[model samples]
Target: MQIKVDAEGDDAAAHDLYYWLRQDRELRRHAKADLTQAAEASDRMNAGEIINMFVSNGLAAASLLVNIVVAWRAARPSPQGTVTFDRDGTTVTVHDTSEETLRRVVDLLASAPPGGASGATDTGESSASSGSGNR
Candidate 1:
């Protein structure tokens, strides 16, 4: 999958690793346990070390999440906007493509000349109308 990590910038390998971790129940359980242990250990460790460890672990987790999201996005065709999937029951949700963007894109396409491409269409549609109207 063509995963695009914002910080890592196209870290497909890292994304695959995270996907594997998520799919494998054993690995997921182990990772959860490890995170918990590390969090607990942070309290007993020196202040500097604890802070460093906490930050590092948090960043790692965040990076993993970014990669997974990118991978999931790539897996789907025509993902309208930011998409999320639930591991249980295979539910998917899309967000982040604000009504403004949707309206602008729709207006852009609608204003195009027959058999011609246009790029200068105005995009000032109101959110209430754009969102409430059926496409």
Candidate 2:
């Protein structure tokens, strides 16, 4: 399974995430993670660096989703923007670091089939939505 992480115009933030994942011993052992630059021939709209990760062994990609959030929260300035996690066609965006947002996303990803993304929202789970909520 492949998980594409885009910082959504935040290349610096993406680079930070790419390196953060690289620094993880467990992630390195279980998956093939690489940083990608926009193809030279690609159009402007698609231009930017994205991290492409391929899951091969023991890692549950969904569970590791928290790592991205963790990394974002660890940022010194903490990006005032969002990061997008795209799997197949289902995209779950992390808007801000909030417990409600975190749980909602965890539930959404966990409920889906392995290697699949189900864009479902839990009405009972309240999010800051200031930067959280389904996009």
Candidate 3:
């Protein structure tokens, strides 16, 4: 037979089944013997075969972990701070000022347009707009 897993709802059940299967004495003995033989054979294996085996096992384990994590994440609802935006008519605005400075800048930017310029004077030093030439 075949086993089907409803990974989201039956994760605990699947783990219990796995434990039960692994606990079978005959199966465990066979597995242990196979592992011992493989270890001995691995000593005789060429460097390439040894490296390939190690890489394959590592990749398989990593793939399994990644799949489980992705499934678990998918099964749960996303929390706040995970922002979603529309494909159209949605704009992201970023300001790199401190909270107080950001608030003031936002207020200033909101009140005036680019070239109209507000807040600081033109001393040839960088103002926010002139620095980027957004004006």
Q: Could you tell me which 10 consecutive residues in candidate 1 have the lowest summed lDDT? A: 47-56
lDDT of 1 by residue, 1-135 (tens): 111112222323233334544574433432331111123322122121110111112333434443434445456444223222222122223233345533332332223232342223332322212243222
Per-candidate TM vs. native?
Answer: 0.25, 0.59, 0.19
Q: Name the best candidate (by lDDT).
A: 2
User: Each model's C-alpha lDDT?
Assistant: 0.30, 0.53, 0.25
Using lDDT, rank the candidates from best to worst: 2, 1, 3
Show model 1 residue runs off by greater than 4 Å.
1-21, 24-57, 83-135
As a TM-score, model 3 comes out at 0.19
Estimate the overall C-alpha local distance difference test score of candidate 1: 0.30
| TM-score-sorted candidate list, best first | 2, 1, 3
Instruction: In model 3, state the lDDT of residue 90.
Output: 21
Q: For model 2, what is the alpha-carbon lDDT of residue 35?
A: 74
Model 2 clash pairs are: none
